[model samples]
Target chain A: MSEKHHIIQVWFFVGVLLLVYGFLILASGLAEWSHPPDIVLAELHAPVWWGALMLVLGLIYCIKFLPDRKA
Target chain B: MTAMMAWTVPTTLVHLSAVDLGIIAFYFALVLGIGFYLKRFANTGEDFFLAGREMTAWVAGLAFVSANLGSLELLGWAGSAYQYGILAAHWYWIGAIPAMVFLGIVMMPFYYISKTHSVPGYLQLRYGSATSALSAVTFAIMTILMSGVNMYAMAVVMKVVLGWNINFSIWVSSLTVGIYVASGGLFSAIFNEVLQFFLIWFGALLIPILGLIETGGWKGMVARIQQNFPGQDYTHAWSTLGRFQDNPMGMHWTGIVFGLGAVQAMGYWTTDFLVVQRVLSAKDIRSAKMAPIIGSFFKMAVPLIVILPGLLGLAVLPMHLVPASSLQPGQYSYNEVLPLMLARYCGPGLLGLGITALVAGFMAGMAGNVSAFATVWTYDIYRPFLRKTAPDQHYVSMGRWCTLIGLIVSIGTAYLAMGFASIMDYVQALFGFFIAPLFGTVLLGMLWKRVSRAAGFCGLLAGTLSSVTMFTLMKLDHRWVAIFALSPKAQGLAQDMYQALWACVTCVVVTVLVTLVTKPRPDEELKGLVYALTEVAQEGHTSFLHRPLFWGITALVILAVLQIIFW
Candidate 1:
C-alpha cells in the first residue's frame, strides 16, 4: 500500500494537470464544434476528442490514486 | 463565443485561445515546480546523477524511450515523411527495433553489473584509459552540440509559429531546461520526460486523427494523395526497397538495412549515453533489460505521430502551404507540416495543447542532452582528471556547474545549427563519425576478450578520423568526380547511409587488424567486462512470452509483416 502511495503521487499530479487542461479544451471544443456561430454538421473534432481523452486519463488517476485513498 | 469567427491560416496568434495559453503556462509552472521540489533531495552525486538508482521498470522503460522522444525524432522524421513518403517509416522500424532488442537481450547484463558511471567509463574499464579519455572528450562535445541543435530547431519552430524572437526562445528554453536538469539531474529530467511523453502523444495525436477523419480514412488518404500528386510512389514502405532510385529517398534497401538499421541506428540505440543513461538507472537487471524492450515497442509506433502528419499534409494541404523545398534529396517544405497541421486541425484550446506538446518535446530533448552532457562531464571528464577523490557533494556541485557550462556551449552550437539545411543529416553524420566507431570498439571490446587495449584506442581514433574523411570526400566528390568515380554531394538519407557504411567498415577492419597484432587482455582481468570471460546472464529463464529473445523475435516478425503489407 505504501509502495503504491509513493508511485501514485507522480501519476496523480500528472493526472490532475491533464484533467485541468483537458476539461477546458473539451468544453471549448464542444462549444466551438456544436454551437459555432455558423452552423455546421457534426464530425469527429480533434479538440473535443483529445480533451475527452485527457478527462478520462485524469479521472483514472484522480479516482484510483486519490489522496484520501492513499494507504 | 464570437459572432462569426472567420478563420485563415494563422501566422502570429497561432489560433490559441486564452484558455490554451493558460494551459501551456500551467504546464511550464508545473515542470519548474517539480524541479525545485526535487532539488533538496538531490544532494548526493548519485541521486542527482542517477535518480538514486531505485527506479522501477516502468520508470526506466518510459524514460529510456522518452528521453529519445526529442525534437529531432518528432520534427525531423515528420519532415522526412513529407519528402520521402512512407519510405521514412524505415527509420522508426528497421532503424531502431533490432538494435534496441539486441541491446536488451545481449548487452544490458554487462551495463547493469559493471556499475560504470558512463559509457566511456566502461570503455576505460575494458579497453584502457586512453580510449576512455578520447571517447569522453568526444562524447562531451557531441552531447552539447546535440542540445544546441535542439535549441536551434525549437527556436525555428517558435519563430515560425509564434513570431517570437529566436534568441529569446533559445535562451528561455535552454535556461529552463538547464535549471531543472541541473537541479534534480537525471531524476527531474526523466520524470518530466514521462510527463512530456504523454503530452507529446496527446498534443501530436490530433494531427493524424483529424487528418485521417478529414481525408475519410487510410484508403481515402492514399487515394487523395495519389490524385493530388500523380505518378509519385507516396504510400509504400517495402515495395520501394528495390533500389536507390526506386524510393524517393534515393536510398537502396542495402543502405536502409546496413547503413541506417545496422550502423547509424544501432550506434545511437546501443552506444549513445543520452539513451543508455536512462536504462542504467533501473532498479534491477531484469528491469534494465526489459526497459529497452518495452521502449522498442513504443519506438515501432512513433512514426504514427511524427510521420503521419507529413503524409497527411500530402493529401489535405493546398499547394501554397506545402512549398517545394530545394534542399538536397528532399523536394518539400515539410518542416512546416507539423505547424500547418496543428493550425489547420486544432481549433482553439487544442491548438494550445498541440503547441505545448511541440514545446514540451523540444524541452525534453534539451533536458535529455544536457543531463547526459552533465553526467559525462562530471564522471568521465571532471572527476577523472580535474578533481580526484572529491567528496560526493563536491562532484555533485561540479555536475550542477558543468550543466550550466554545457548549456552555454550549446547556445553557441545552436547558432551553428542554424546554418544547416537538414538537422537530421548533420546529426546522422555525427553518429557516423563518432557513434559508429565508438560502437565498433564497444562491440568488439565486449564480445572478444582478445581485443587489446591498444587496439581499442587505435580503432576508435581511426574510426572517427575515417568517418570525417569520408564525409569530407563525399562533399568534394563533385570537384573530382571523373577521377575518383565518386558520387557527388549525396543528399537526404542516401549519402549519409553510404558514408556511415564505409566508416563502420573501416572502423571494424582497422580494429580487427590492430587487435591481431597486440596481446589480448587475460581472462582474469576481463571478468564482468568481456562477454566470454563473464558469467552468462540467464535472465532466470523466463517463460516464452516473457523472454527478451521472444519479444525480440516477435518485434522482428511484426516489422516484417508491416514491411510486406505496406510494400
Candidate 2:
C-alpha cells in the first residue's frame, strides 16, 4: 500500500507564526503594563490589545486548518 | 518627541530587544521550514516553475497581490502620500484596481488556456519566436536588475533604521531568500508572499488605526493637513488634477486617466510576468480567472494602510518633513515617514513584528523577482535557445541553479546601485521603456487578427526605440520635456505619462502600418492565440456568485464608489 502524504496548508504555518509572535508580544505588554514605554498613545496598551487580537486570529486559523481536520 | 525626531537625527532610530529579535528569527525559520518542506513536491520543471499548477484561487490571489506588495512599494507609496497628499491613492485605486479586474475578466483566459510557462512563453505562441526572444532577454535582464535594486534599497533601509551594517543586511537577507527560493522554487516564494501579506497588515495596520485615533478620524486629519499646508490641495484626489500645477504631483486628469490608469496599469497587471506568474499557478481556468479578481479587492484596500499613514503623518507629526534634496539636520525626508511612524508608535514586541514585516516584504520581493527571473532564464531563454532538448528534470535542475545565479547577479547589482545611486533611477527608466510598448504589442497580438508576426516584432522594436530616444533627448536637453509633455510647466510625473502615451501611440501606429503590408497568419494557424480565432472558455454554468466576471464587476462597483467617496 502507498503511504498517504499530508501537505501542510500555508495558513497553518501563518497561524503558528502569528501565535508565537502574539504570545511573546502579550507577555512583553504585560511586563510593561505597570509602567508603559514612553511612546505616543502608549497608555492605550496597543501591544496588549493588538497582540491578543493576533492570538485569537491565529488560534482560529490553527483550528480551522489543522492537518487532520476534514474540510 | 525624541522618538518622533529619530528619523532626522538617526542614531539607529530604534533597537530591537531580545523578544523583537525572536519574532524576526521565528519568521525566517518558518519560511525556511516551509521551503524545505515543499522541496519534495517541486520535482519537475512545471512543478518548480509553476507550483505544480494546483493552487486554489485564494492562494494564487493572495500571492498575486503580495508579490507586488514589496517593502519598497509599501514605503515608497506611503512616502508618496506624504509628498503628494491624498493624490497618491490614485496609484492604488484608479491605477491598479481596473487593470486587475480587466486582467481577470479579459486577459487571464488567454494566458491560462494557452498554458504558457511565462509571459514570454505566451508571446512566443502569439507573436513568434523572434518577438519572444526579445521580451525574454529584456525581461530577464530587467527582473535581475530590479531584484538587485530592491536588495540594495532594503539594506540601506535597515542600515538607516537599525544601524545594521549594509553588507550584513544585504548578505544575510539575500542568503535567506536565495536558500528558500532555490530549494522550493515558486512554491516557496508564493507561500512566503502569502505570509508576508498578513505580516504586513498586522505590522502596519496599527499605524493608521492609532494615527486616526490620535488625529480624531478622517475629518480631523484632513483639517489638520489643511492647517499645516495652507493653500494646498493635499487632501483632494481628483480636484487637484485639473491643472498640472494645481497639485503637488503636478499631473493632469488626462495623464492620470490615460497614461497611468489606462496604459501603465494595464501593461503591468495584464502582462508583467512577475505578478502574472502567481495567477498562472491556479489549478484551473476558473481559479486562474478568479485569482486577479480576488487580488483586486486587496489592491483596492491597500491605500487604507499605505496612503492613510502618510496623511496621518502630515496630520500629526511634530517635525517638519522636507524633500530629500532639501533635508536639514532637524527635518526628516518624506521617505522616512513610515519608519518614523513605526518608531513613534511601536514598542518592544510590536517593534519586532514591524521590523519582521519590513524584512519579510524585502525578502519576498527579492524572492519573487529572482524566481521570475529564473523561470524566464530557464524556460524562455536557456531551454529554448541554449538547450532545447533537455529533459524536464534537467530543466528543473537548471531552474534551481539559475535561482542562485540570479541572486548572485542581484547582489552585484545592489553594490552597483550603492556606488551610483543614480543608476537606480536609470534602471527604473529602462523598465518603463518596455512596459507600455509591450502592452501595445501584446494587446494587438491577442485582439487584432491582422497583427502579423513581423509586424509584431517591428512594432515592439519601434516602440522601444522611440521610448529610449525620447528619454535620451529629455535627459540631454530639459527643453525636450516641454514638447513631449505638451506644456513647459509639466513636471517629472507628467513627462513620464506623456512619454508612455507617445510610445504606446508609436507602437500602435507602426503595428498597423506594418500589418497592412505584411502577410497575416491564416485563421487556422492563429487559433487559440487571437481573440477572434479562439473560442473563449465559458466560466461554465457555475452559479452567478461563482463567476469571475460577477466579482470583477463587483470590484469595479466598489472602485466607482471609492472614487466617488474620495472624490
Interface RMSD, every prediction, one decimal place: 4.9, 4.6
Fnat of candidates, each listed: 0.31, 0.63
Lowest lDDT sum, 10 consecutive residues, model 1 chain B, at B1-10
Instruction: Give one digit per residue, the lDDT tens place, for model 1 in B128-201.
Output: 77899899999988988888778877875766666566766677777788888888888788888988888888
Clashes of each: 0, 0
Top lDDT prediction, candidate number? 2
TM-score of each: 0.92, 0.95
Model 1 spans > 4 angstroms off: A1-9, A34-43, A66-71, B1-13, B320-332, B479-490
> What part of the reference interface contacts, as a 0 to 1 fraction, does candidate 2 reproduce?
0.63
The two-chain DockQ for each candidate, comma-separated, is 0.37, 0.49
